[model samples]
Target: MKPRILLVDDEENILKQLRWALEPDYEILIAQDEYEAKRIFEIMGPAVVTIDLSLTPGNSQDLSGLRLLEYFLTQAPSTRIIVITGSSDEASSLQAVRLGAFDYYSKPIRLDELKVMIKRAFHIHQLHQRIQQSYPGSAEGFHGMIGKSKSMQEIFRFIERIAASDVSVLIAGENGTGKKLVAHAIHNLSQRKDNPFAAVNCGASPEHSLESELFGHERGAFFGAYAQKRGKLELAHTGTLFLDEISKLTPALQVKMLRFLKNRKIERVGGTQTIDLDVRIIAATNHDLLENNVFDKDLYYRLKLVPLPPLRERKEDIIPLAHYFVKKLCRGRRSPPIMLSPEAEGALLMHPWAGNIRELENLISRAVVLSSHSVLKPSDLGFALNSIPTDVNLKFAKKAIEADFIKKALSKNNGIVSRAAKDLGISRVNLYELMDRYNIQIQEFKISRSSERQQMKTGEVL
Candidate 1:
């Protein structure tokens, strides 16, 4: 069956024309009034809808369409509602958009233009539905680190293999790539899960204080040493110590770290007593220790290396990670799960993500809290349509649209590749080729439907 599109308009001719123009591509459900529209909307749950700003035949100031718009949005926030208004009523059309209408078309409807807009709306609706369906549990793959890309899956397997050992591990990644989270995962997966995991930033503290902060200090060790205190190394005895930004450590501190790794022993400042500790060291650095002159070769070589790719390097994980943040952050809110519109998802994908996961998380959190509508659009995510680069080649744009269309078709058919191919008017082999080319996972779409049905049974949205 074709995707449903509810058309709400008072004019008989207008309704007939839309039905005639859109019926070929959509299952058209016509509503002559606000009441009929609401009834049909609740019953059919159309993915895309069109409503006139003036629903009452004679009253130019009825505003009933606006009321219906709000009602439809409240009842089914995921629906893509396009408002139909006269050219003179641009203000009301804009107001409808503000009230959560997806897009607006003027009175003199150009069937061709409206058709394109409607297709785009359905595409967006499909994307949001896919996200709502697939994203239920946390996206965290291993020990609270979120990612499902091949790179991250490999990291998960690697962490599991090496976590039980007591080797000193070095994690290298750009800032905000979650090196610290990786360290924590290793520690939690290891036998030291029950022990305390201590963390210290090598570059955050002053040089004079960093040594004492790591190796502890006895009473009266310095002018400010009012009492004896155990440092991170001593405090993490029999557990894990996370040294963040290890490349920033000065030469003197690096030597101290090397010595500690060698014998697992430390000497307190201003005290002769040597402390023997049983602790595991997990050091992280944003800089490339091999290329930079900031790190000691001997110390770097002693730590087993784990490198993390930046967010842009793993584009496949962006959407899932975004949805994960949306669900996680909206748990405390009274409303249902906040959704990312197609444009928002595209913006997230196109972004360079210079800050990696941290940047994405912050954007989603802010969107969840600040977005007026339950459905988050590009503006809610602090991205404008103009922000997308316009210099792209025609081939890339075609590929993007093609992939989106295929995904929608698959989603509409509940991931039955054969049915989806039929719906798309293509052969199974051709569809499979497209899916493979775009790395589209049919099983994920299939899983999304099951998960959505389960969530619906429990009265959980997304």
Candidate 2:
């Protein structure tokens, strides 16, 4: 199929030149003014559009072209936009990027280089379009989640249900299950979708900061209280506030949170007024909240627990979830849907995902980038299970759990970091961070590859 192109310029010569150069690759449509350009856009819905910064009515000042770019971004975000600017207008060209223009080329067009950029942009456009078509939802609806398994379908149902109400939702899943993504989905689908969706890790922050962050502090409340600052609850008013790892909150904070849950009111650290909050609270826990005494039963009960079945128990959803994350992340790469060989699929089923869905996301992503072949084999998934010692505790340290999780995904991806990152829905940078955090060695991992591939192969995957 021939790709469609829309060319806009005030200068007659430039339009003719671009048409002559890019015509071999696309059916080019030329427009000399902003009004004509938009008309052509509405009719043609071109795959790629190159618009000059200066148009017929606003030749010297390029505000009209800027507005056109903004309109294009808002109306047809999948369309790749390349802005044409004068040689002297570097500042204005950069401003186009700020307005969400895909790429900018200075005037006095270099046809050869500009064509390459346009082609690359179109590829990315096509990829993102494919994602939208396949998912049938905005990025904010699904974001990084990739699942079609019955279990995942159930999770989607839960998200839809909770998003309709203001009741507190408690998401329960094993480590690395994308609970945070679920919380985000709930917020995005709710009545407060347009409002602030604030999040803070209950386990990560210091106790004092957690208190101040959840409940605002007045000036002179503590040593660091130089000025009055509203906490997360106050800021999240009329929005959704996500408290991740709720089971990890200190007992003291749990008591305070319980009060907030009941009263829907907060007292600043040094202030007397009890501020009311209209925020929806969503809490997540990797721990077995019902069994763990470390987690407050009163607060957990109040939060209204939503239990998430671990990946092991929901084996039917593995392939669907794998396809989802891979398709979503590979949107710009134009990468094909990754195929898992029957052996690979068996490996996915056999392994109990201790880290759950998060581990799966990292594995598939890594495999997509690192696999030379389109189909992923068992070896490609690094699924030779590592032996775990009985003494190694997964309960307390989040990093310890994360390390075990990555190791499993790496094993599934066959020690491929890029694939592992995708499988886990994390960036390659994050994979490296996990390696360091867990002190894992890739060499001991069964799937062998490049030098850095040897990095954390030895990490325990339990």
Candidate 3:
């Protein structure tokens, strides 16, 4: 059965557009007013809901949409509610997010962005369900991560214990051991859940760009600085900032970061003003920064260390994580439920996963896409029972897959960013960010004006 989603909006045109776009992937139920929405909620019990904050047109006094949001939460707190508001209604949208709504979107609706948000909501809800089923009567560790081993349980307990405190945290883990997820869990469980949770990758970004990205810069900060921009550190004020791969930070950047950690103030690039910020620092590293002479000793001493066990060490959790990824990747697809064959399960267990959880997920994703049969065997996963590839660069592999998809989308859309983003089921802004990360320029995919004119003259659509 398709995952059910409820759409609550007074505008008929919006409802029609949403239904047309989302009907293929979801069982969409439309409600034009609060009474109808309530009735549908009681009967259908949708897993996801999109509600307009101003349900009654030209009636500002009637907060029917917000009331319905409250009512839905009261009835089923697990149901993910996405609030829709006017473009200028920031206060109401923020209020919705604060009131336990999963997320909010503003009008006029960008279908790509809204669709991405809806898909995320469904994924989160299903993931929560999977975790509860996997752990049985265990306490909820975190929303987006799955772990059932003894070591993971202890780690969860540790997170819960330290989440309430305002001290700096340093998470040490291998590449695919989910260091960032742990950071998110800590931030979500803390008092700063509602605040912005900003993240930057020290290894992925260039050292020259990483500094400006971390700290805001004045308009005349550097040669290419056209306007003043707030960096991740400043933007994460009163929230949490996650610095991944912190061991890769340069000596100069390390000194600057350490200064900000010591005093809750930062001076922007080429700016004299020191801005005070109440941001919590959560840094992750694949290597031991203290043992490595490259990292600053003062910074190392300031952070509370938390180590994450790699997947190979916690072998008991491998099958569970595999099953979780299989379900997550296969959900909402128009196909029969896929299961792992006995041979496949055995092969998975025997393989030494050097790339950790990420490798497993990537393998499962490939199988899901390529396998025709419902039962996936060892061969379906590109794994032989005897010899499994152990020297895979999982990070590069994942990036290659992402970059490939973006290139295909851009090609299909003739290099138009908005169209490509829609084709990829993501916001244009998100697509641009990915393009930037991969150093993909739209100009590379653009057709020449002469070629376009030639095609037009030939009676072909340009």
TM-score of each: 0.56, 0.56, 0.57
Off by over 4 Å in 3: 1-141, 385-462
Write model 1 residue lDDT over 1-462, tens digit each, in one string.
688899998789988988899888888889998787876665456788999888875677788999999999876677899998988988898899888899999868899999999999999998976675464333444555677766688777777777877789988888789997798779867888656577888989998799899989999999999999888888788888889988889989999999999998999888799999999999998887867576788998788777788987677778888988888677636468778876677777778889999999998888888877888877899986577665433355446657867886786577999999998899999999999999999886775556778535323211
lDDT of 3 by residue, 1-462 (tens): 688899999899999999999999999899999898986675456889999999877777778888999899876678999999999889988988877799999899989889999999999999976776576435433545678766687787778777888788899988888887798778877888656677888998888789999997999889999999889898788889899899989999999999998788998898999899999999999997867488898998788777887886665677677787788667625457899876676567666788888899999999999999889988899985457434333343345457867886786577999999998899999999999999998987788778777445322211
Best by TM-score: 3
Error of 1 at 159 (Å): 0.8
Show where candidate 1 strays beyond 4 Å: 1-140, 389-462
Global lDDT scores for all candidate models: 0.82, 0.75, 0.82
Using lDDT as the measure, name the better of candidate 2 and candidate 3: 3
Give lDDT for model 1: 0.82
Better of 1 and 2 by lDDT: 1
Please write out the lDDT profile of model 2 over residues 293-367, one tens digit for every residue. Answer: 776778876665566767765565666676666676666366666677655665665567887887887887788
